[model samples]
Target chain A: MSGIQYLFPEYEVVRNDDRCIRCRVCERQCANEVHCYDEGRDKMFSDESKCVNCQRCVSLCPTRALKIVKSDCRLRENANWDSDTIREIYKQAGSGGVLLSSMGNPKPLPVYWDKILINASQVTNPSIDPLREPMETRVFLGKKPEKIVRGEDGRLVTDLPPQLELSLPVMFSAMSYGSISYNAHASLARAAAELGTCYNTGEGGLHEDFYPYGPHTIVQVASGRFGVHEDYLEAGAAIEIKMGQGAKPGIGGHLPGAKVGPDVSRTRMIPEGSDAISPAPHHDIYSIEDLRQLVWSLKEATGHRKPVIVKVAAVHNIAAIASGIARSGADILAIDGFRGGTGAAPTRIRDNVGIPVELALAAVDQRLRDEGIRSQVSLVVGGSIRSSADVVKAVALGADACYIATAAVLALGCHLCRTCQSGKCNWGIATQRPDLVKRLNPDIGSERLINLLTAWKHEIKELMGGMGINSIEALRGNRKMLRGVGLNETELRILGIAHAGE
Target chain B: MKRVYVNEEWCLGCHLCEYNCAFANSGARDMVSALKGKPLVSRIRVEGDGRITYAVSCRHCTDPLCVTCCISGALRREDGVVRIDRGKCVGCLTCVLVCPYGAVAPGPDGAALKCELCLQNSCGAPACAAGCPNRAIVYEEREEERS
Candidate 1:
């Protein structure tokens, strides 16, 4: 084990000697200790083996003299057994542990959003200018009455269920405090408040410092129920029951003891330096009735003033499962697809477990309408909504809103290095270390997040205006404005859209 | 007057500000040719313990002690900026000793060196403040303290 080396360094740190001024800025900024100065040689050198390709050194280099590139050296190529497959086998043989990865799945799977083309008004209908006229992007998520009800006096009943309102149909999904840093959560909370949107507190109870932003918070309850209290339950505008996540659908979550620092432990109500592991499934929820009881319990605890959301992974029978949740008194259903992001997950389970969100969203919407219970629950789909176009496509396929975590963290300076499991995030969004966490100032992070969402809001308005739809409510479930470019008959039928030529 | 201020909370202590200052004042074509294999004499320096850090430079106080103590007339207060005239400096080291913030230092040619907010350089503004990645060093004007 000590003599043989099974793997080679994947990335090479290229430093231009002529351009490097020996400022040593890269050496100081990297948390991985990849770069160091050899005082005797009067030069700087990098240890490529420790480099994660996170681009921290390259970004902070004062002279722009550093670049990271994938090593060109490779093993003999085979069509069926690629280099990555062979490397994974060697790694497992040596370590005897499951491969862990961070962020979303990187496989080249089918992306329905890319295949779907949007329509525009031609010579007949006129397109509205968003700058000149009013374009309503606001949406309210909650159950709606099937028909107008009248009291004994024949007057219209105006009372409706509690709802979660948003300036735009996009939200920052659940990335818990224990999984990310305090500054990341601070940035999200401030940005959500500024944008008139909501951010989910993924199973990590609400931090006391974020209580002022409660109106823009969604507290989540998972199988472990890490920090469930009366104050914690009341600290958010809505509650989410996280039955499963998109990444590692059938497995549970585990935050290593090293990351369970005092702040994270206090926030999660766990002892310091102890691992926080969530069970695979809720112990009390074996059937739909059990789900209904929990939903009602949360609603009752909140005094029936806040909406309840049930989040589940998009799987084979998602349409039927959504039907059960809709009838279980849950006001909102959040479906996480296969490509969702996570702080840590088994590589195999993350790569191959759940179904694509586009098909799941379409099937559930159609099934709920067929069952005449579509009005009882609102649908929100998440996994990898990358841009405004994805959000627009999701709404056209009957999603009330879209949840985005990877894109949100990217806005806060994540390079998508896919090495968050190591917990030494150089960019500061995923690490709990005080030095690394301080790298992300909430002032800059919040401003950047606000800028990203504000830009997306304008793009959404433009896309809606191009379709001659001035309001988001008018674009909801409007499949007539969508066409499939490379979809087969079954996919086109499932998506309920016509072929591009037709 | 606009002045450079430091907020210790966000300082990353990466020393990029010091490098930017040296390069901006070097007057060379680029940072590589100016600072390569050279001992840096940056006008701004960062002072920190392990846990906390902050950049220090000329404060340009209302009544500067360095300006009063310069016997060779090298240090002068011009439009609220305490600037050093390297040509007239006598290398007495009086200003370096008199500066309370320890910002005044001797240059390579035995002249007193201090921060002029980059006004004398091609930058036309403070490079240390501009190059700060975390906005820890800022150049702005705020309400004066009554005391």
Candidate 2:
């Protein structure tokens, strides 16, 4: 085999001989096959070169003897001709291919949430204790009737359209089955079911075992339209029309042939081991009017039983985009920001494209309210809503709910190694390898997810209580409670918040 | 020598480490008495903004930059744990600027507070590891280097 290495291996695995138990938990847990037992020497050895510093082997090592350290090796330090850029050059020269990266962009971008402050009641208003008062986090997302209806017989008519009722103002974002492990999907499904919230099935299609979670699932139909059928359409509580993603923006996604195992192939309704690449844009949709057509068509296909959500990336013209989406006969709009994670994407696009979710959400919400179409649809904001404070800020910025994935992954023991594309996820959340997949117990994963969300819900209640807002509805679009600290006039104008001490 | 190490994956960012550390060094019998109205400026801190969170404290580097950068002779290393002398001299923040982890910060009293491994006032194991709810923080030493 012709050997060509572009990037230096970042981690070196250290195995202790005296503490070796030979249980092979590390061997079984690693998808890269770094660890192996030599029958001739009867000893456990690791190649070390295959390590990604994911800490899978180190965490699973029974004897606690395994550790990974950053390689001290370096290329001559130059800022412009940096090691990473040089390595990329070498790799592209060798393979003549674009460098693909996984997870969110790690660049130091300005996060607007930290720049915004939430106002707490002092003398003018008294902060209510969440423990003593009822705070409503429950939300119904759909087109609400402009006014209460009255029947001809004088009996009050309660007939209304279908809405997605959430126990809290948070839900699991779309992470495809092909991108994450079966156990991860199962954990999300179980957690959503137990929490009475919804989990999205990203373009990869829904799994068969998770049909019991259909009532809490939001199935997506992307440009590729994988695993989509009449039953698949009707199986979910809501259907999402994914026009674009925040990670790649203008670019589409491609699940490699190697990741398309038997189960992923079946669920995706694609031939096994074949590359599945979604096109940049839906062939049928070229304009906002075309998007409306598709939205109504999905509504017709599902007999208008399930709400149709139009999901898009937060791009430069997001306000205009959301305005059109509001008129698209869709019930909800899901906007994912730039810091969103991906299974894999060209490194250039992930780190360089798209705007922040906070700015996009505020702009869209303001535009819709200005256009007097705010009640026409619901908005769910995602991408880097890390804490309950993030959720409260998102709601105050005019989001109906928040979608979180990275935080959910953290609850399931992910170390944020950002090696999700390697498919050797030691935590078993993002990998498909059976060995690594089995390492994550669905029961435990779901419980941890529930615990994280429950804690966040309590925190959200406290934050709302401090604002003197007893209900989430009262907090939604309540911009008076938010103030900007270090943002400029334009930034504050876009966010619709006054300066701190204003 | 045992030093405070972290498995940041298990850290829930609960900030209990800071409370326990202050209480242990406060010489107060209970937590409420030690930290009732006084805003705490603990040696160890958790630093993160949303996407990924991790605990940050003294790594006690063999050749610590903070010790070298300190002009007031306030920062020092003893027995492998980086210790701070708040009363030595000035509140110059050179160590805070030099520390890579952003672990060193100006305390409420204008003195720099950095993790001292709970050695100045305690006898038992470090209070942080003992009070960590998730056991994400631990006091341990490196494995023996193999030939």
Candidate 3:
């Protein structure tokens, strides 16, 4: 059978003769069969083709004599219709086999920055200078409910729901410890506390080390319900019932045993690897009533202290589904659009399954308002809420707050190569490998995340101030202050905003 | 005879091989606690610009000079695999200065360590190849492109 080359061209281990100390560390430490000892030659012979560029031998040599560089190779290039560089390499190597990779979207698509122009305050309404004015960045996420009346004893308290109090509108989305690493979870937990918001412990149960950040954590209960005991239920201020995710809407995730070490297995309540599969749909939740039962069960289990959030992917019929969710007794409704992040997922589902958050949020908001149930529950949208502008746009479309994952990672120095499913994060934010995990300094990661959110919060405050709004509460559903620049009549109608220059 | 090969296109650039390489070389008992939230020191690396990524590690070549470059005889090729002797390593990083692939790295104890193909602990295979989710990096007796 024809196959890729069995061996690369032999590379010479070049050394600076001026720097040679005759240290034997390189011969003793190399893992590949690259180095050879020839007693007759009285010198070590190096085969360069075998070197992997790990830099292990280089760092270990006391005499500093080792250096591994890539051998010179040329590629045939035809810019006219050649596939991607990776695809071409695979074609050359795998004989034209379909190349597979793990985690998030890799394709370059159109970013809506220029398409969605930001409305600035001009002569009509003066923009409030954040330096001089009190710009409120506070946001509440949960059911607003109806009717808060005074009791017979004259103390104000009737029937208002629980909400997540945020000093800023942005939050850390659900990224499991098992999916990333224990240190990754710790960094998120600490940053959440520092930012006065919440970091989610995804389907992976809360690690014991993070229980102290209970006040700033959102514990998720997916269909698998891994490590979801009564304690895990009560450990967070809010409970998010993950119905589906944008990355793989109709599919569940499987953390292979090779990646699931002892700690991840214990925390997730699954055998080490063993194909931890979370089915596409909740077997028990067959109907709206069934969803209501689960929602009430969680609230009852936590004595109503924690608000229950129903997290659903933004599918085509999201408006109707959201209307049902609003009536299902959930305190918050979190909709994930198609472009969400995941540790691993099928390629087809990530790019094709769910709808855009913009459309879904607008539709859901319109439906709930039309049904007079807008006050029943709060809304949170995820699946690539990229920047402060996206957050503001979501709020204009009736989202209370936004859940950010990729942005959070970017803050922590993630280049968004989308290889998270491989479980080896070069930056050490993801992956379970002890050595790779150490690459991420949690103190630095947490502080960087805090900085990102802090800066975004200030930007959000400035945006709100320009609209003549002092608080996020005032901006909620206040679409009159927004004017669409490039949107069509339908887009403007759906967004509940007037056309520009109207 | 021992070698490492990467299926570049299949490589997701996740860097799991790097972590696995680092952990396998760390000599730590608890993998999770050792790796959690720490800066990485892996013997292998995922190489690529933003648009393309692939795992790059030691290939364990037929004729090796890293062994010849070691003045202390700390690096040796036994049978078909390259092995590092930490006891004699003075942490002078001489092998690092010579190898073309940049494969040699420092150990946790400041000694020289490279991909030993997971032979020391007899994990049966290289940890990076075993742990890679995409099967991008593979360890075998010969580098044959499998269809």
lDDT of each: 0.94, 0.85, 0.75
Query: What ranking of all candidate models by DockQ puts the best one first?
Result: 1, 3, 2
Q: After superposition, how far is residue A348 of candidate 2 from its true place, in Å?
A: 0.8
CAPRI grade of model 3: incorrect
What is each model's TM-score for chain A? 0.99, 0.94, 0.82
Instruction: Flag regions of model 1 displaced more than 4 Å.
Output: none
Over A1-502, each residue of candidate 1 has an lDDT whose tens digit, in order, gives 7588889899999999999988888998898999999999999999998999999889989889999999998999898898989999999999999999999989999999999999999889999889999999999999998999999999999999999999999999999998999999999999999999999999878888998999999999999898889898898999999999998798889999999988889989999999999999999999999999999999999999999999999999999999999999999999999999999999999999999999999999999999999999999999999999999999999999999999999999999999999999999999989989999989999999999999999999999999999999999999998999989999999999999989
- In model 2, chain B matches the true chain B with a TM-score of 0.88
Model 2, A403-491: lDDT tens digits are 99888998888888887888878777888876456657776789999999999999999999998899999999999989999999999
- The C-alpha TM-scores of every prediction are 0.98, 0.74, 0.66
Best by lDDT: 1
- Output the better candidate (1/2) by DockQ: 1
Q: Each predicted complex: what DockQ? A: 0.81, 0.01, 0.02
lDDT of 2 by residue, B3-57 (tens): 7888765564546677677778788776556665466657777776633456788
How high is the DockQ of candidate 2? 0.01
Prediction RMSDs, each to the true structure:
1.2, 17.1, 15.3
Instruction: Give model 1's docking category.
Output: high
Give the per-residue lDDT digits (tens) of candidate 1, residues B1-147: 899999988999999999999999999988988899899989999999957989999988888999999999989999989998899999999999989999999999999899999998999999999999988999999776321
Worst-scoring 10-residue span by lDDT in model 2 chain B:
B138-147
> B39, model 3: CA deviation in Å?
27
